[model samples]
Target: MKELYDTISLQFTLKDFHQQKPNLAFATAEKQQLIALLTYMRDVHRYTHLVFVTAVDWLEENRFQITYMLHNYDIKADFGIRVMLDRDKPVMESIHHLWEQGRVYQRELHEMFGIDFPGSPGVNEPMILEGWQGPPVMRRDFDTAKYSLETYDHRPRDTREPESHMKEKLYPED
Candidate 1:
C-alpha cells in the first residue's frame, strides 16, 4: 500500500496524505491530473471496480469535497480520491470514461449536492427533491431547520380529542 502511495505521489502532485483508521485518502488534484491518476489506477494498477462516489460540503471553507472510492478485489484494498471545488461553481471532470458506474454516482451527486460533472450525460435532470429551491440539502451551509421553516407551513398540534376514560374507569365502558 505504501508502495502504491509512493508511486502515485511521485507521479502526480498530491495535496495531502490522510489515513483514517480504516481508509486512506488523498486530497484534491487538477482535473487533468486527476483523470490521469484514475486512468493509471484502472489500467496499470487494475482497480477495475468503482465502489462509490460522493461529496461533502465544508461550509467554513465554502467548498465541496468530492470523493471517488475505487476497489480492486485482487488487491484487497480500496483507494479514495477526493477533490475539492468551490461551493458556487462546483465542477469536476466525469470519470465515467474509465468506469461506467461513475455515471450513476455522478448523477446522484449532481442531484443531491448540485455539483456539476461536465460531459456527463443527464446531469441536468432531477433524481430527487423535485421542485426544491434554495441551497442543496447535503451542503453544510444549508440549515435544515431554516429550510423546514421556510419551505413548510407550521401547524399547531391538535388537542381536540379527550383522553380515553375506559382504562382509568376499568369496567365502566362495558
Candidate 2:
C-alpha cells in the first residue's frame, strides 16, 4: 500500500496520507481535483468498488470534510479519499457518473448536510425526510433540543422508580 501511495504521490497532488493498516489507507486531496483523482484510482489503481461516501462537519473550521471510501477486490485493500468543502457553500462535483450508487449517497448528504451535488439525479427531491422544513439536521449548528421542543408534542406518561421497579420484579414474593 505504501508503494502504491508513493507512485500515486508522483502523479497526483495529495496530502495527509495515512496508512491505517497493510490494507487500509486514507489521503486528503483538493476538491477541484477530486473527480480526476477518483478516476485515476479506479481505472489505474483498480479501486473498482466504492464502499461508501460520508462527510464530517468541521464546525470550528467552517468546512465540511467529505470522505469517499473505495475498495480494491484484487488487493483486498481499502482507500479513503477526503475533500474539504466550504461550510458556507457546501458543493461538490457529482460522482454519479463513475458509480451509480453515488447518487444515493449524494442525495442523503444533500438532505442531511446541505451539500450540493450539481447534476446529480433527484438530488433536490426528499429521500428520508419528507414534508420537513428545517435546517440541515446533521449540521453542528442545528440544535436538536430546540428543534424537538418545537416540532414534537410532549405528553405526560406513567413513570416508575428504577430501584422499586427492579425490587418488585426480583422479589415479588417478599
Candidate 3:
C-alpha cells in the first residue's frame, strides 16, 4: 500500500494518506490529474470497482466538492478522491471510461447539484424530476420550503372536527 501511495504521490499531489485503515484519499486541482489518478488505480493498482460518486455543497466558500469512491475487491481496500469546483461553473472530468456505473452517478450529480462532468453522456436528461427550475435541488442554495410554496398549490386542512371519544364521555356536552 505504501508503494501505491509513493507511486501516486510521485505523479500527482496526494492530499492525504491513511495507513492505519484500509482507506486512502487524494485531492487534485486539475481534472486531468484526477483522470490520470483513476486510470492508474484501475490499470496499475487493480482498483477495478467504482463504488459511487457524490458531492458536498460548501456554501461559505462558494464551491462544491465532488468525490469519487473506488474499491479494489481483491485487495480489500477503498479509496476516495475529491475535487473542488466553483459553484457557478462546476466542472470536472468524467470517470465513465474507467467504470460504466460512473455514468449514472455522474448524471444524477449533474442534475441534483449542477456539477458538470465533461465527456459524460446524458447529463442534461431528466432522471427523477420534470421541468426543474431555479438552483439545483441538492445544493445548499436551493430552498425546499420556498420551492414547494412556489411550485405546488398547498391548502390548510381544517381542524374543527370534534374528537371521536368526546361523544362517549360523561361531560360530552361541555
Candidate 4:
C-alpha cells in the first residue's frame, strides 16, 4: 500500500492520504485534478472496479466531499479518491467514461446532494423523490422533522398501556 501510495504521490498532487487498513486506503485530491487522478488510477494502478460513488455533506466546513471507492481484484485492495467541492456550487466531473455505473451514482448524488455532473445522463431527472418541490433532504441543514410535519399528515397516538390492551383482548367479558 505504501509503495502504491508513493507511486501515486509522485505523479499527482494529493492533499491528503491515509491508510485505513492493510488493504484499504484513501486519498484526497483537488477537484481540478480529480478526473486525471482517477484516470491514472484506472489505467496505471489497475483499480478497474469502481465499487461505489458517494458524498458527504460537510456543512460546518462549507464543502461537500465526493468519494469514489475503487477495488483492484488482483491485488485484493481498495482505494478511495476524495474530492472536496464548494458547498455553494457543488459540481464534479463525470466519470462515466471510465465506469458506466458512475452515471447512476452521479444521478443519485445530483438528486440527493444537489451536486452537478454536467454530462452525466439523466442527472437532472429525479431518482427517488419524484415530483417533489423541496430542498435536498440529505443535506445537513435540511430539517427532516420540519419537512415531515409540514409535508405529511399526522394522527394523534392512541395512549393505552400494552399490558391492559392485551388483557382486554384476551378477556373480552371482563
User: Which pairs in model 4 have colliding backbones?
Assistant: none
Give the runs in model 1 whose Cα sits over 4 Å from its true position: 21-28, 158-174
> Model 1, residue 168: what's the lDDT?
47
Tell me the deviation in Å of residue 96 in model 1: 1.4
Worst 10 residues of 1 by lDDT: 159-168
Which lDDT tens digits does candidate 2 get at residues 1-174?
788878888878889999999899999998889999999999999999999999999999999999999999997999999999999999899999999999999999999999999999999999999977999989999999998988899997989999999999999997
Candidate closest to the true structure, highest TM-score = 4
Error of 3 at 9 (Å): 0.7
lDDT string for model 3 (8-75, tens) is 88878776555556455444434558888888888888888888888999999998888777788887
Candidate 4 Cα lDDT to native: 0.91
Error of 4 at 43 (Å): 0.9
- With a 3 Å backbone cut-off (N, CA, C), the pairs that clash in candidate 3 are none
Q: lDDT score, residue 67, model 2?
A: 99
State how far residue 53 of model 4 sits from its true place (Å): 0.3
- Which sections of candidate 4 miss by over 4 Å? 160-174
Error of 3 at 171 (Å): 6.0
In candidate 3, how many Å is residue 5 off? 2.8
Q: Report model 4's TM-score to 2 decimal places.
A: 0.90
